[model samples]
Target: EPEVTQTPSHQVTQMGQEVILRCVPISNHLYFYWYRQILGQKVEFLVSFYNNEISEKSEIFDDQFSVERPDGSNFTLKIRSTKLEDSAMYFCASSLLPTGSEAFFGQGTRLTVV
Candidate 1:
């Protein structure tokens, strides 16, 4: 079985710094998404991408953030500026079907800002 992979399993950044979280979503999938979970909170959707454009996004994916698939294989999330509240475990998920299909998720990248 194949799975999504994220680099730097954990990251530590300064409050005002920039961070780019990287992920390689499942191959041959049609939809890809980024979701995050605050330390003790439920997982929440951040953004969804398909066909080289953003298909959907949550409020949390404000101007401060952006997502792009620079290459066909890697999906990246960039935070222009980091904040204490931005710290969370970010997950990358992909599915062949747009909806109603099982989404495969990466282990998650834990971001810590201080």
Candidate 2:
């Protein structure tokens, strides 16, 4: 089965540098989302995209964050100014469904801000 894939399994960045995490969601999926886990914290939703536009976004998706689909299969999340607290495991998920449907997650891109 097709699955979501993320790059940079681990990343270390200065406190104020820019970062871009990449992902390739399932081929037939209709909904895409970004979620993060801060160490032992619970997984939190950052944003959701569908039809090439943002469908939903959490407060965590502040001005410093942005997302894009640069190609047919790649989805990317960019942080313009990374902060120390931004250190976390960012996961990409996709589903050919709505909010109530089950979603599949990528291994994740670990971003460590120093």
Candidate 3:
């Protein structure tokens, strides 16, 4: 079966640098999303993209973060300016349903900001 793959299971970054976490989503899905979970917080949705443009974004998706589908199979999330508070497990998910679908997640990209 196909699955979403994320690189760098763990990442450590300085407080002001940039970080790009990569993901290869399942081959046949139509909707893609990025969500983050702080060490002790709830999973929060950052943004969702479809049709090569942003379909929806949550408040946490501020100017410092951006996402792109650089090609047909890969999706990427870029943080322009990392902050200590940005340390969290970033998850890439895909689903066939626009909303309320069960999403499958990668093990996760654990970003540690210092």
- Which residue ranges in model 3 land beyond 4 Å of their true spot? none
TM-score of 3: 0.95
Q: Candidates ranked by TM-score, best first?
A: 1, 2, 3
Worst 10 residues of 2 by lDDT: 93-102
Model 3 over residues 1-114: C-alpha lDDT tens digits? Answer: 888999889999999999999999888888999999999899999999998999999998999999999999999999999999999999999887687777778778999999
- The candidate with the higher lDDT, 2 or 3, is 2
Q: Is candidate 1 or candidate 2 better by TM-score?
A: 1
8-108 per-residue lDDT for model 2 (tens digits): 89999998899999999999998999999999999999999998999999999999999999888999999999999999999999998966888999999
lDDT of 3 at 25: 86
lDDT for predicted candidate 3 compared with the true structure? 0.92
TM-score of 2: 0.97
Q: In model 2, what is the error at residue 23, expressed in angstroms?
A: 0.3
TM-score each candidate.
Answer: 0.98, 0.97, 0.95
Model 3 poorest 10 in a row by lDDT: 97-106
